[model samples]
Target: MSSVLLFFQGLEHSPLSVGLRASEWMYPLVNTLHILGIALLVGPILILDWRVLHRRATPPVAALATVLLPVARGGFGLAVVAGSLLFITRPLDYAFNTLFQIKLVCIGLALLNIALLHWSKAWGLAIKDNQFSQSVRLACGLSLVFWLLVLALGRLVGYR
Candidate 1:
């Protein structure tokens, strides 16, 4: 009866949701794309984070970022679009799912970590001088943790 519930109910009954729910192939196709998108997003992130953490073992941070950021951004975009479509199919269910809630939180934190890192002077230090300060290293470590949590929680959201 509340506005939020009403909004979700409306989403659940939308033409797009109804069509996706009734379709035999569309849901599966979107699900596949969501998985692929996560793969693309997480894979680059893992490599980049690891490289940042282990500064001596990889190429320059800027070089790797230049190559990886676009792929990660594309993946994130795809995932969000596909995920939104999937969510609309059962808006209330996802809106209430605790696992889904946690997944969203983890994703937010991961994105925030990225924003903070890029905005801070640590980023330039890491990129130009190959120097990662404690905060930068901690951010990279947290990025890894947050993303992994998001991945696991996403799977659990579907499992439950």
Candidate 2:
């Protein structure tokens, strides 16, 4: 057997994994937290994205970001931790699932989009001067698409 398979098998058989699977309420609670985490993460992002995309910039990008970014980070952290816990319950199955893999890729793309936006000169201009450049707008638009795809694929991962 491949070492990769062995690793997943080991994860499935670990004490925490076994306990979570065996528990009546623990898995459900964790699943609920995952949903809530996604809500928290995506809600802020969508709102911020919408503001950026809007023709009339009522609330400035920097103002919205200052309020939303921290909440998004908190949500992302919770989702990752909870998602990791859930993955261990059936590591082999999820590790091989196509939807799960796609979801991961979409998440990577979303993160990359965020990084590019933050690292670009346009981001600074948008925040400091209320100047929304083409690049910043494009990044925000792509962020909406990528994150929405990630959300959909995450749901589909279970159905597969």
Enumerate residue pairs that collide in model 2: none
Candidate 2 lDDT, tens digit per residue, 1-160?
Answer: 9999999999999999999999999999999999888888999999998888885657887888999999999999999999999999999999999889989999999999999899988898788877787888899999999999989998888887
Error of 1 at 106 (Å): 0.8
Candidate 1: which stretches are off by over 4 Å?
Answer: none
* lDDT (0 to 1) per candidate: 0.93, 0.91
lDDT of 1 at 13: 99
Decoy 2 TM-score against native: 0.97
Question: Pairing residues by index, what is the TM-score of model 1?
Answer: 0.97
**Candidate 1 clash pair list:** none
Tens digits of per-residue lDDT, candidate 1, 1-160, equal: 8999999999999999999999999999999999989999999999988988886845888898999999999999999999999999999999999999989999999999999999998798778887898899899999999999999999888988
The lowest-lDDT stretch of 10 consecutive residues in candidate 2 is: 52-61
